[model samples]
Target: MTQIATIIGGGVIGGGWAARFLLAGWDVRVFDPDPEAQRKIGEVLDNARAALPGLYDMPMPAEGALSFHDRLEDAVQGASWIQESVPERLDLKHRVYRDIQAVCDPAAVIGSSTSGFKPSQLQEGATRAEQIVVCHPFNPVYLLPLIEVVGTPANAQMVDGVADTLRGIGMFPLLVRKEIDAHIADRFLEAVWREALWLVKDDIATTEEIDEAIRMGFGLRWAQMGLFETFRIAGGEAGMRHFIDQFGPCLSWPWTRLMDVPEMTDALAQKIADQSDAQSGQHSIRELERHRDANLVGMLRTLKARDWGAGAVLKGHDKTLQAAGRIADTLSDIADPARPVLTVDRAVPLDWTDYNGHMNEARYLQAFGDATDRLMQIVGCTPEYIANGGSYFTAETHIRHLDEVRAGARIRIETQVLSGAGKTMHLFHTMYEGDRALATGEHMLIHVSLETRRASVPAPQVAEPLARLAKAHDSLPRPEGAGAAIGKR
Candidate 1:
């Protein structure tokens, strides 16, 4: 329901936020002080728009309008939500907030993508103080699920409501109990960064070594579940209290100076840069970003399978998107019943895949989705129908993968409408090779109005064809499966 969003910054973080909101189907307006903000953001948005929609199992609706504003007030006007990702400086943020207060509607929520600055500090002198809060997201804003929401006492109620709204849009909002410098996640990150600096400064470990130690070890688990949840599981039946009791001694160790900020010396800076250069070699910045996004898509999808923490957020977002519908081009492929279809038989090329082997998991869903799209088109649901204010939104889906699929496999998909109704439709999809079923996806879809965001009669142009198909299959028994659930919760 977050239909219009304004992004007040065109840096990496702001661009990522724009991608996230735009992909989620919000009309996005971007404002930034930099003269080249639009160009930089456009480049980022180009990759984002190409990669984001393809991550899901359903075709996402066409991205909403993406426009840039030379003035912050112009961007904030009438926006439902405003995200400020401006430079991390107090005076600039204050100026922006003052301008936002004068322009943003009373109902709109204003969030600052600040890593550490508190709401109290960020909202100083703002007339509409309750509307402002800090929403700290990690780098690669579009991929990471966690956004720390820090609110001052005066704005806590408004911020909590905003957090819920963010959840509705597929973001995980962690509400900080109290305001603190650097907020919560950054505090932990700052600690690690401090140690990383010490290691580089003393020539004890290379940048790659430190990265490996974390990634090959705890970093993997931390990516899916946070530090505390992992520790809770690690304690087995003992729970958090017991785990804390056992490891509390580490708290006193001189291993990390959590409060210390390392001095920026040229010798240490050069060493860090040289080590990083040696670690990454000649990969371009774009390549590195693609790698990061690919890994994020894979790891997040894996965690989504477990439906714990970050994965839970991804799943929830997927559900929200299910309502948006996707469009796929029809292909002239059918399933052959006699062979074992490999998973790679039906795949779509996602723009974000890196040099790493295998398609990222999000793209796997996207591939199966491409097959689903072709199936829908074959059955007569076209973009023209959707544009006429009628479209199919996926309600639920269950996909089973029997094997691993690598990239570049010639894939085909077969679909069967499991059931249909005025408001709901069910489909069975099989990704296939020439004669085999690789993966099966059963989905339920709802017919909806684009403007209402509610169930509505399908347009005659689209409905007539679907009704014909329904009649053709009426005498045929429903597929030996459950139909999609219909009606509102």
Candidate 2:
């Protein structure tokens, strides 16, 4: 079945939604009146393309097509899901919803990406209003996994399906139990925003200071464990109740004016704009975005190792990705019996380059590791199978660097299964940029019982595929330096 998603606006949030759904293999139709909406969305998609795939070890679903529609009716015609992200105006939203209601598929679920409006507010005077829910997302939605799903009880049940769809695109759907003026995350953010504004208005701190306070402190903790868990840890093993009991009284102090609101005069807005520029004027927005993305990717990847918070979500999703075989085109699926398998074809990003403006030594190993992982999948030692405790562990690896690969150089790895008849599987990989071979690696791996953490013969399921692949490669002539590369013949 072809799943279709519709976006009724092409602003940041809408563009992000388009990227998310489109990348997840849903045909996406977008409608917006702005002349530059497509261009803007294109830019977002570019950023998304560069950042998203790096987050996963497994290949993502082949990208679904994205199209822009001039008419709202055209956009929502075949949509299984319709998301409205127009400017935050009740009348405008209601109009868009009406337009959508007339043309949208009868079974399509409706979501409005409004930060200020509750689901009840958005559903007002709209046809099939019971299906309208507020599906608020943060900025850079493609990177951030959180989405706050809010709806009235009567219509809230429909949101579960919406949550499932969001999950398919690697988003974490946070259900807001009750519809309120600003859903949960924003409410917390608004409180912090108010405090920050006061800090600025009072001349107590600069915008940079406030941001540093976040990125340096609670922000790091929140990214992984969130508030309650951090606080629970602060309780020194006594847990939540004890922590709350200990800190309850401090909450009564005048440390913050949570109820206070600052008047936003033109002068105040100018002050903020000026302060923001002063804080980060050195870097262009794109540069900053790339910097932010690099840090986030590094942080998230590290967290993946520990299986905590956002990392946990990413890790879980990668399993779903591997299980689905979402990418479809694996090296083995397209290999020729006459040639080595083309297991990896990717560009070395700027971040992967070293100080010499060439691909770093460790990255060469990582790329080969990615190729090895793909090989593991072809031979049935997939993430799921490995979870059951049988897989190959590298016992020895010898790499020869013949040339340097610079940043943004598209590289490929062709692998030959040298031998795979027993507990030991020997493989060879050569990295290339076009016809130029840059490096070669000879790897010797031993089948391991993950439960025992030692070498053991693999089960019939894995062994059979490994043997088949080895047999297929047995006739290929061995490349030069086979004996010198890894020593053992």
Candidate 3:
């Protein structure tokens, strides 16, 4: 059954939530009164389609269907989940919840995207109030993983499934054990914002300087380890306790103006806005989103290599995404004896080039590895299969560089399954820049039981697909590079 999510607003945060669910293969129904809601959400979806999919190496589920409805009732009817992201007015939210209760599925989880309102406040004067929970998400909900979920004790049982649903969409649900005002992350942000307002009001620092203080310094640290962990590391040989002991005395200092609220006169607001515009006026929001996505991708990949933090979550979720799709099988539908599987097609970004301005030698191996992964996906060595402890381990590889590829080149890989049987497999991948062959990689791999870390024949289900693909490729003309050694020739 298709998972249906009803999104009740289409503002920046609401549209972002829509993108997240829609991209995660949930059929989404969006209901917003604004005439411009579609255009706004469409822009958000464009950014999402470009950024979210690139977070994973493997393919995500085919994007789910999206439809817009004018009536709130039309949107919520039959939805498995209803996310209410309307403006944060208590009475308005309660009215929306009452409307949702009338049309929503009894088991459907209704989440309110109110940053200031607690679940108890939202439930006031509302029918079926037990069904409403606070699920506050940050900006660019399509990219950021955190969603602070809070509910009353009466709704405790519903949280487990809600958490699972959030996880399925690549979101990290911090289940608030106790419902509190502003939740956790927002409370920290409020303190920072308060200090920033005071700084600007007192002319102590400009908006640009405040932003610079973050991005140029501790923002990088906070991105990965966060406040407590970063300070713990600062403790050095002593750890968090000692670090706190050293810094604890400063907590009482007037160093921070967090306790005071600065009156935001129009002039101050304009000063901040003008400074922001001066700082980033050159780039549009789309350009910024791309910039943010690129940096995020690099950071996430770094964390992925370390198997730590958000990147680890992203990597783990990639497996779930891979398990959700039939991309490899869909591509393999056209498998034939004379044709190689056209596995990867993408532009060679500037970052892939070496200092000499040519595609690095290692990139050829990387490209071949991607092709091999695609081949594995097609031959039933899928993420799900691997998760269940069945997979192929690369035992050997040989590659020949035929030509150089420059930056911004469009590249493609064609993979030929040379031989595949019970325990062993052979694959040949050829890289091309347009029509010119750039390199060839010949590889030998073995099926293994990941749990035992030993060679094992795959189960019949896996072996069958491998056999079929191998038989289909049996008639392909072998390349001249197939048996060539690394000597002079």
The model with the greatest TM-score is: 2
Write candidate 3's Cα lDDT for 2-73 as tens digits.
Answer: 999999989988899999999888999999999999999998897777667656656566679999998888
Give candidate 2's error at residue 473 in angstroms: 1.7
Candidate 2 structure quality by residue, lDDT tens digits, 263-362: 9888878888899999999998777977787688778777887998888888989888867752324335654644677777655655677778777889
Residue range 1-489, candidate 1, lDDT tens digits = 448999988899999999888866789999887899888888777666545543454435556789988877788888989999988899999988888888789888899999878899987888988888888888777767679998887786787688887876567888888889998888888889988998778778899999999989999888767788999998879799999889899989887755676797898898889999999978987788876766766676667778876777767776665544333232223243122112222223344354565555565466666655555565556777666677778877777765544443345555555455577666666666556655666777788889899988666655665555555455554433333332325
Tell me the TM-score of each prediction against the true structure.
0.70, 0.86, 0.79
How far residue 368's Cα lies from its native spot in candidate 3, in Å, is 1.6
Off by over 4 Å in 1: 236-246, 259-261, 323-489
Compared with the true structure, model 1 gives a TM-score of 0.70
Worst 10 residues of 3 by lDDT: 326-335
lDDT of model 2 at residue 241?
Answer: 89
Which runs in model 3 stand beyond 4 Å of their true positions? 326-364, 373-414, 419-426, 430-472, 477-488
